[model samples]
Target chain A: MTYINELDTPCVIIDLNKLNNNIKDMQRFASKNKVTLRPMIKTHKMPQIANMQIKNGAKGITCAKISEAEVMAKAGIKDIFIAYEIVTEDKIKRLLNLSKKVKLSVAVDSKYGVDMLNKYFKKANNNIDVLIEINTGLNRCGLNNLDEIYSLAEHIMNSSNVYIKGIFTHAGNVYGAKDKNEVNDIGKYEGNFIVKIKEYLETKGIKVDTVSTGSTPTAKISGKIKGVNEIRPGNYVFYDAIQHSLGVIDIGSCSLSVLSTVISKPTEKRAVIDAGSKSLGLDKGAHGISKVKGYGIIKKFSDITIERLSEEHGILSLKNSKIKIGDKVEIVPNHACTVVNLFDYAYLTDGEKILDIFRIEARGMVK
Target chain B: MTYINELDTPCVIIDLNKLNNNIKDMQRFASKNKVTLRPMIKTHKMPQIANMQIKNGAKGITCAKISEAEVMAKAGIKDIFIAYEIVTEDKIKRLLNLSKKVKLSVAVDSKYGVDMLNKYFKKANNNIDVLIEINTGLNRCGLNNLDEIYSLAEHIMNSSNVYIKGIFTHAGNVYGAKDKNEVNDIGKYEGNFIVKIKEYLETKGIKVDTVSTGSTPTAKISGKIKGVNEIRPGNYVFYDAIQHSLGVIDIGSCSLSVLSTVISKPTEKRAVIDAGSKSLGLDKGAHGISKVKGYGIIKKFSDITIERLSEEHGILSLKNSKIKIGDKVEIVPNHACTVVNLFDYAYLTDGEKILDIFRIEARGMVK
Candidate 1:
């Protein structure tokens, strides 16, 4: 068997045991809370891991784009939820084609999105189930006003082939939480607000089947809420520094890391690794969430800070450290989802032996 | 012919005429200065573009990794220089194997890297050319001391199958310059410093064939310096916002842009696009150079600031702009190199008509 240390530098490695544990833990949490787990495949972007999540009791998988959903569907994932608005004609056409292969549900927030979907679906004589997105603090692509939500839902219902499947919201604003208490408060509001939106839609003669809301930081708290039935947490499969900083997971629970080699010792206190922004990715929590201080966490050298990154080099600020050139170090990235998207393939290991190599099949599906 | 407006959103579009002009202008500048133009291919990572550079009079191509060199080599480029240190045995072996296919030379700064190359080359009964990397200004991975550089060159010369072909430096610090004057000063210093190192090495009985130093912002100034014979500029082929901010090029000269659609109009002052950090990479100069004000520059709406991004959503802070839902906007990314690595393919356009499509062949070659 091959070992991880024998592999090349600047490559991604997933601790298989930790990955299985993370998958099982999240699945168990959703099962115990009576919530349908639709883990977002955008985190791993690997069809094998998504199949494993399905084998461990995930009711469906959620994606950020239709291209990603198409990748999962081609890999035999039967149920897929595209948790984003489809407004453009090319994407709407691709979405209709994708709906023929799997049980697909897309997210919609505006009348423009609904009309685009209706125009295409009506021409093709096909129907698509869509989740009405509610704005619960993450004011990205969701309807916040009750009247707008009502009118959008009415417009979708009046369309020839569009139907309402559920109501969902991503409480991505919890990423800006200062502490665990704030995260808990945001999680409670996220769950209650989406459920309240579902109730209001029901009162308006629109039957919302699924009340979905989640992010990794708020998944457990939100899933446990009374009326929430679906939890779509993406980052829990390989919890990153952002999740750890927000008190969501421990550092040891992080399964994904970029195995890098120290290629240079420029000074007594500065070391350079072979991995940089191209491999590790430059994501420290987008949307001004600056809780993550550095680019990544060096596994055994917590005192060593990854100060900066070039295209192919990561500079480390060492503190009286004996890290020399040729020393191999594994880096836990600040954000796992973006890091995974940078590599073409990742190795599955069990801390000692390389178990298998899985292609990040859905990576760069940004069309 | 298909038109660019009919293409999908959140996709990369390259203006063919501007791209050709950029390539031709850089080549003309290098030729006029009597410097060998060896353009770095990490910016576009497309073999078609690299061939275009070759046709425009670039003597050779430069890459950050051996895998990228292999990609270019497979496309029948004769000469390549991997301007990064290769430390591990596996990579050294790959480097040696790649040398048989083309003229290959790599960079070395530390004795450890030279020793690693020496040990493998001796066993394989083969030799390879290497360039001594000097720390002109960017303290990422190069020797800064004169004594150490002499000792490392001595070590390489004394080895069984390692040869010194040149000395090089990348003045990447020009990205942090406050104004055009500072950039010019840094550029002049960058070219003079490497040429001085080459002269010093020659005085010590070591013959240096190539004195190479460059970055996009410094290439023109450095190439014009008296003794610098080679310049390697990667981003001038696309001339991103970082180059524009450094006053190296005008915004109209930028050839690369992400065609994104306004997916959501959250409020009158806030607009959301289909692109984000995934499409436009979060590289506002990696070493805390924050001269870039936003993620990218919108083509027509200069007042719209891309304030933040999620994985797939770019939130724009608009100023009473009429950007509505389903409106398409072209965004010039802050850094073209990292942004190009985010996609699998890019479309080539001539103003309004689609010319062709090229695969980003060497995109994720971080290893």
Candidate 2:
């Protein structure tokens, strides 16, 4: 059997035991809360992991792009959700094609998006389900005002080829939570707010089937809320330094890391690893919400901060650590999703023994 | 003819005319300064572009990793300089195999790297050329002390299979320059510093054949310095917002742009594009040296700031702009190299007409 330590430097290694445990824990948590888990595949982008999640009890998978959803659908996933707004004709066409392969639903926050979806699906002589995105917070997308939500729901229901299946909100703002208390507060609001919108839509004779809310940091709390039927937490499968910093999980729970070799020890207190932005990624957090202080946390040598990164070099600030050239180190990146996107494949390891290699099949599916 | 405007959203587009002009201009500048151009292929990672550079008078190509060099070599590239230290046994074996295919040179900053190289090449009964990396100011890698440099040079000279060929420095510190004057200062120092190191080695009875220094912002000034015989500038082929912010090149000189679509207008003052960190990259600059204000520059609407990104969505802060859903917009990313690494292929466009598509053949070659 191959060992993870024997793998080439600057490669991604996923702890298979930790990965399965994470999947089981999240699935169990969702089941206990009576909320269907529709884990976002964008975190790993590996069909194998998605299939594993499915086998562990995920009802459906969520994707950030139609291209990603297409990968999942091709890999035998029966239910998929594109959790981002679909606009351009090329994407809408792809979305319709993907819809034919699986039970597909898309997110829509704009009247423009609803119109485009309606136009494309009507021309294709097909119908598509859509989740009206609500802006409980995060302010990135979705409608915040009750009037806008009502009007968008009406617009989607009025469309001949479009059906309003649910309402969802990503409380990504919890990533910026000042403390665990703030995370809990945001989680409660995220669930209550989306369910409130679903109730509001029902009051107007509009049927809202799903009340979905999610974010790795707030998923458990939000999923446990009354009336929230679905949770979509992507990063929980591979808790990163950002999640760890936010009190979401501990270092041992991190399933993924970049296996890098110490390539240089330029000074007594400084060393450099082969993994950089090209391998580990440059995600402090979305909009600088994370409290992560450096590029990553050097596994086992947690005191050694990854001070900076170039394209292919990570500069580490060390204490009295004896890191030297040729020494291998594993780095738990600040953000796992972005880090996973930078690799073509990752080795699955049970502790030190590498079991298999899985392709990040949906990587670079930005279109 | 296919038009760039008609292509899929969140796709990379290279202006063929601008790309050609950039290649020619940089080649002319290097030739005029009497320095051999060894453009780093890490920026484009396309064999076609590397071949074009060679055809336009580049002496060789530079790669950050052996895998990238392997890709270039497989595409019939004859000479490659891997400007990073290679450690592990796996990488060294790959390096030796690559040496058989091309005239390969690697960088060495420590005795550890030199000793590893010597051990591998000796075992394989082969010799490899190495350039001593000098830390001019970036402090990321390379030797800054003269005594250490002397010892490393001596160690390599003592090895049976290792030979010292040159000394090089990447004046990446210029990325943090406050203005053009500072960039010029760093450039002059970068060239002179490596030349001084080469002279020092020579005075100690060591023969150094080449003296190299480069950084897109500092290349022009540094290349002009006497005794600096080689320069390697990667991003000069497709200058980005970081280069523009550093006054290295104008926006028109930037050949690469992400063709994205406005997917959402969540508020009157906010619009979201399909391109996000996945397409544009999150490189503000290495070590936070870049003065770039945002993730990228939205062409035609300079006033619009890409405030933030969420894997598949770019949130734009708009002020009275008429951008709407389904409208196509091109964005010039903050860093071209990282941005190019995000795509599988990029469309070559001669203004509006699409000429060809080039695969990013060496993408995700972090290993």
Which candidate ranks first by TM-score, i.e. highest? Answer: 2
Residue A100 in candidate 2, Cα distance off native in Å = 1.7
**DockQ per model, Cα:** 0.76, 0.81
Model 1 misses residue A178 by how many Å? 0.8
Per-residue error for B352 in candidate 2, Å, reads 0.3
- C-alpha TM-score for every candidate: 0.98, 0.99
Q: Model 2 TM-score?
A: 0.99
What residue pairs clash in candidate 1, if any at all?
none
- Clash totals for all candidate models: 0, 0
Residue-level lDDT of model 1, residues B298-332, one tens digit each, is 99899999999888999999898998989999999
Candidate 2 segments exceeding 4 Å error:
none
Interface RMSD of 2: 1.2
lDDT of 2 at B149: 94
Model 1 chain B weakest 10-residue run by lDDT: B281-290
Consecutive 10-residue window with the lowest summed lDDT within model 2 chain A: A281-290
